[model samples]
Target: MAALSAAEQTVDTEHFSESMHSLSSDAEAFPADSAEQHDFVVDFIEKEVGSDLKSLKNVSNLLKKLTDENNVLEEQVLTVSSSVPPKVSAALSAAEEARCSLEELLKKERLISNMLHQHLQGAQPWMDNLGQILNQVDHIERHMEYLRCLQHIEELSAAVQQCLMTSSVWEAIRAVDSMAALDTGLSQSACSHLQDFLRETLHFWHKIIKDRLTIDFEKVLTQLHWPIISPPTQSLTPTASSPEISSQLELLVTQLLALQTSDDLLSQKDLASGKGGPSAQTVSLATPTSLAPPLCLPIQIMLLPLSKRFRYHFFGNRQTNTPNKPEWYLTQALMWMGNSTTFMEEKIQPILDRAGADISARVELCRGLLSLVQEKVASDASRLLYDDALFSHLVEEVLQFEKELRSNHSYPAALPGLLHLLLEDAVLQKWLTVERKMAVEKMDAMLSAEGAWSSQYKDISDMDELKAPDCAETFMTLLQVITERYRALPCPSAQLKFLGLQRELVDDFRIRLTQVMKEESRCPLGARYCAILNAVNYISTILSDWGDNVFFLQLQQAAVSLGDDVVLRDLGVLELGRLASLEGSLFEGLLALLDRLKGDMLGRLLEWTMREVIEKARPYGQDRWLSLPSQHDLSTMTLSSSACPMMLCVRDRLLHLHQSLSLSLFQLAWQGLADRLNKFLYQDVRRENPQKHCLCFYDLSPTSLNV
Candidate 1:
């Protein structure tokens, strides 16, 4: 890259050449094609040097004034030195030294003055004078350069004729271009003659060279033994694998690319031909475009016959009938050519051992050629491989080739262009589309089979057997496969597609699980409660184990609303001072159902024990009422809760019941049941301990107070 920058710097330095002679010496140099560039250069030159005459006049006048002052000082110093006193010999010595110094200064000033005067009076006017004899020399030089350029152009014409006569089309191209670059200052008659010569000579060269190149190309086709296919050739690959195809393509690319480089060098040069020749005061110069590019016309014509075969071999069939670009062949040819040239250099460069012609320029030029074709190949290759299979095969082949290239430690300049053509984002995205569809289908197949949803539940009723879903492992495998596909593609939108697919899968699974939960809720209460708790616990456990994976985080979030798990998880007999903590009446209903179903025998036994306790309370309650401290106490004792003593048996039976049923609902039911027991026991406490001054817990009816 640094070397390329240096080459650019060198080109720019030589472009605005120091002199017309230097410009002519570098005969390849030509002005830019823009007409404005020529005028810009001329204007820049006029601005740089148009004041030379005026500057010379001012310098001459300043020098003359300094000379006159020096002469006057010399005369005054000499007079003072000659009249020096004999008694002060030191003063006389000083005066004589000063005079000699002043005299030396005058001589130097006079020499400078004379030189400037000569430049102004002699050189400047002489250069401008029409009457001067030097004008004849100027005219002679103009006529001589005109004759020289004419001779050079004529020699070029003859060279073209000679090359075509011998069927050397490459040499004909060089000669024709040599004729075109002749920018000799032209009078009307000379220009007319030059134009006529070009019109005739170039046309003849074009006709013969095209024919010659075409013949050469036909031989190339025969040498390769390629199939002669019709227009819009079949898609095939074996022909492109041939090593000889690249070698033959290189031969054609090298000749044309060299010509293109020569034209480019010519175009950047602002000045042309000799400045030693007379100025173009009367004659107008020819436009630089007269010799401009598309300089490889012969080469392009040769490629036309070979293109059908090349397209079939390297590019395959064109799908559309729309005509391919004429220049598109140039890019295809350049790629194969660049690789071939680089390969040849590797083999040949090591063999030379500093013995012969340097291949450095050839190598650099080939490297430069790759950049010119990069954009075209990148665009064309992307369009060619839109099919998933086609794109996949091409990418695999390119990657394998790239791997081999690296293993050999060979870096070809054209490899970047080739690789760029294969690694297109559109191609990657196409693969991602295929991968996503396949992944989703595989996932669907795993779960869409007979009783597929049931299989995922896998003995969830048995806690130890409740492992991850059967499809979980297979789903992960598919996920990984799709993830790798996404990694290979490495696109923003592709990554989004991957994430979205996983999200949908997770969501669908969660929705199915939620549906199962709702369905299970319809079972007998005990069974339904156990089913929901076990299934949700198993799911939570499995999901939690896979919890670190982001996909499972979505599942966990879905499981949040799965149960009253949050309400049931921490409630115990110790914490059940109230039933308000439960989400709704479901807790109360569940407790009653459980007692009816599982605790019925225990309830009947407690009822039998309470009947015996209620029989013992018959008369003790009536005697305790007469022993009351006052009538008010007796009035309060009108009601008796003699059955409250049996509450001890209730507490004991409740303890036994509590031990057997410790669920959230059992604890909740106990809260209301305990309060009712307290209300019955309250009347007994007031009647038995009258000094306690407490009222009866119940407001008994008169008939009901008989106990």
Candidate 2:
């Protein structure tokens, strides 16, 4: 048994050695490149030997253990070998397939993108070409339409020219020498055709030019430069065909001149006459004998030779050649001269002559002449009847006429007429009041020069420099004149003594007050003016009455009228001062007035007056003289200066008023103070001084509170 066991072991050992040798040979042939390969070999050997050595208790147990271990080893080896090779092969194939699919998709996307790009590129040119083609077609169609319209217009113009040139039409037009005497139906037809032709021509031209081409034909006609004809020589050869037309034109001119002089001829009457004098029975018609012969007489008179031989032959004898002789030649010459002179005299000289008759009439005439002059000036006409020299002459003539009217005392009854004339003339109306005043002043001067009344010129000139006088003297003079005229007339007029007395009283009061204001220097000029105004205001209060006292009422009304000048002057000063600082003198005058107004209704009135000033006055600019200086620029010297001290005094006064008065009064006082402060602050800031530093320091200190 031991030998058999030995023999089995030996056989196993030998078998193991042979297997190991084969494996070793295979390993050598392959040349194992890793430690894993060496580890696998060692592990196989330990598994085969370890199981056999650990199981000595039963041979069957050993065998069973060994067999189970061998089976597990065999299965692990098979599983590793088979599963690894397939998995590796499958993985490699999958990776390659995925890469190829991805590449194919990328190529397809690229192709699609390229196709879209090419498509857009191809469409762009087609859209541009289509747009260009449409534009060309539209332009061509528009031009074609314009050309067609132009063709129609040319045809219409030609037709119109043909109609105008017709022989029958020319004869018919010539037969009626005057435009008014032409057949109504024929004229209407002609006018209609002409208008239609013009319309068509204008439309065609507009279409051709592709713009507006319409012109004002009437304006063009008025501006036409007609050629002047020279005198024809007796030896000149006449064209046979032109004679009839020339004769017809000459006849037409003769008739037109005659018709122009006939003012009574209406359109219907002229049209019905048909070139012959109106029927003998017509009520409105002038007698054929009464109407002057046609202008052909003048043409004939012009044709006569001026030689002494011809004159002698035409006059026949010495008795007929006398200056006053009534020979046919003399009569014709006189008639021609008279006609020419009449036309000129009526058109120009009479206008001025009529104007010179009275002040009002002269004013009206001057206005009309001015209007005519303006029209000519605006038109820029080549020939003006009234040149600068002529206009100056006319003005001098007007002045002379005014002088005459003043000497004659014609203005009282002519005021309304003068006003009407002035209103009608644009040039004269611009300074109507000034012109009227000048005229009145000139009259007054004349009266003074003539020594017709007391010399008020000195008083007037003195007052003119100081202020506008209340015009009370003039009003009074007018009232006195009217009352005297009314009283001196008759028994019925004697009752107007009451009216005269009242007028005299009112006038005396106004004149005396005005003189007092002018002559007296006791009070401020403003106070004196205010006093005059107060008197006028009192008169106005009486005048506004609608009650019965004819003469008394008029006297009061005159006083009221005198006040207008004062009010206007005051308002003007107020307006001017609103935009600037009030003059020191003016302010002093106002302060004087204010002092007088204390504790009275005048004080209350002042509140309203100042309110009006504040509301109506524009806010002054920052550059105004009253503006204050900035803190940085202010100096101690400035603070202690005369102007600053005055301002501070005024500010203190206003502060007192603000505290003592009602809210409204307080606000007004504060507003005045604020305006003053602002002026000082802003304006003083711009001035430079070394003392400014000290003043600034003083301002910063608590002691500045008192300042």
Candidate 3:
């Protein structure tokens, strides 16, 4: 048996080796084909099964297992196959019924499609006819509207003409306005010839009504002798026109206002350009009808006579037209307004009141008069600026006139047009130069004048404080004059320029004060030093007060309109700083001056007092305490008259300073002197004294020291 098993194992090993060689050959020969793999399997089976009976037996058993599984699969297939026939028959029956239903539905769809096609074909001509009817209706409506617009325009034209003939100014203006509205209401396509005719008719009536009202308005004004120019010497009231003239003038003005409609003008322009209709139209110069103030034409008409008179007197080579005397015409303009404005308010204002016009009669008259004044002033200013004297005089007069106009006549705080000519950069620079030169001259004269530092002492009242020197008082007065001159300047840039000039002058004044202080510092007398300290303190207080003043505040606010973080950069003194900052700088500089002056004065006071005390103690220094007193030295035991003189000298100096200096300043000096004297006597005097004589502090009375 062992021999048989070994033989079988040898055979199996040989056969496996052969099968491995064959499979390698098959894989190399046919890597992707199944035929090579099948042949290899057949060769292996034939070799292995034929080589041993046991292999054959294993194969036979496998074959029997496959046969059993095939039979089972066959039975399962038979079971499934038995159910397929009935289900297929049922599906066929259902399909046959669905086909019949689909045929019926298709027949109904064909019939419905034919009916819809027929209906659409039958309605085609009716829809076409309806579209044509709609077009015709639109045309007819537009034509009717056009005809109605033309007819309304004709009616308004006839009504306007009749109203004008009947002197019905208000009715005529309303009729004219209605005609304008109709003309603007029609579109550009509205019958060209008819539109041309209506426009011509409207223009004719518009011109006639306007001309007639203007004529009647002027006639009444002529009767009242309008724009009566009053002389400076004469009173303000003009020759009074009767109530009847005023009533007529009011009616004419009301008619003019009623006829004016900014909306109609703008709409007509839009229609001409084919741009917009009434709803889309916009006014350029004025608001829509009745919302804007009435046009200034009527007031301008009343100003015609005055304009002619002004041109005659100020524009030409007349004796009164000299540039040297700009105030003649400027003042005349103001005077004319003064005379006519009141009359306009009392008489013509009622017309606006009854018509519900939102405007001031006085303002209207003033503006008209100022327009003429502005032109005259500008023309003369351009020529007169070449001559400094004449220009200065002109500026002075203009300032005076502005002051009177605002203070007395209730004009605005500033009027730009009135001062616009003066706002030019070149003009401002020249003006600033002139002002600075004049200011310097004034300052020099003030400082050179006698008693400039004198106190102008008066008996002391409870309310009175130490008086400032004449120089300080006059300097502030000079500042006031400069401030008032530019207070009413209208333009922000111009006001800033003036502010720069003021700051420059302030710096110049500070320099002058410093120089004066230096000159007075060397003097042994304390009066001038006291005066200098008081002046600085006084001027500093004045500047602080000005910082809070409305005038200075307004100047500071005016600089804001330049829309800059910094302004007047060219002016070094005010570069990139506000008026308030410059004010603070000025106050700080004065304070520094005050500190330095106070310190130096105190030192000088200490030195002078100590020198006098030493002089009075010189005799005591000679008579040394080294010698013992005799037995009858009772008089020496009492306080010596020598020490009394030194104490008296110190007391007199303190009293003199108390009377000379201001209270606050005197208190600082006294306190400082006390400290220094105590230190000197304790440290310096004792250290230098070889004999170590006992030092004595005098019991100075408070009443004598004025402490």
What does each candidate score in C-alpha RMSD?
33.2, 30.5, 14.8
Candidate 3 lDDT by residue in tens digits, 287-335: 2233333336567567678778987877787999887787788778777
TM match of model 2 to true structure: 0.23
The lDDT values for all models are 0.46, 0.38, 0.67
TM-score of each: 0.30, 0.23, 0.63
Residue-level lDDT of model 2, residues 1-707, one tens digit each, is 98997776676666666866876777777765435665687686666565574332244454578799999999999989988988999999999999999999999999999999999899999989999999999989967855654454455445434533563333322322222232222344434554344444433422222111112211221232111012222322334544553444344333323323221233333345453343222211221222222222112222222223334533345554432222333233323332333222332234334433212222333222222222222222112123433332333333333343334333333222111221223323232233234434543553234332222343554433212223433443544443443332222222233343343345444445545544533332233333343434334333333123454344334323443332124445564443133222212223333234322323443343334333322222112332346555755523333234444445555554433333333454456545544444334543433333433332233233222
Off by over 4 Å in 3: 1-172, 175-207, 230-247, 262-295, 412-421, 456-464, 490-494, 524-529, 550-639, 690-693, 697-707
lDDT per residue (tens digit) for residues 325-396 in model 1: 423444344444443443335432332323233334333333333333333344444665555554554444
Pairs with steric clashes in candidate 1: 30-266
Show where candidate 2 strays beyond 4 Å.
1-120, 165-513, 516-707
The Cα error of candidate 3 at residue 174, in Å, is 3.3
Ranking by lDDT: 3, 1, 2
Candidate No. with top lDDT: 3
Task: Return whichever of 1 and 2 wins on lDDT.
Answer: 1
Model 3 TM-score on a 0 to 1 scale: 0.63
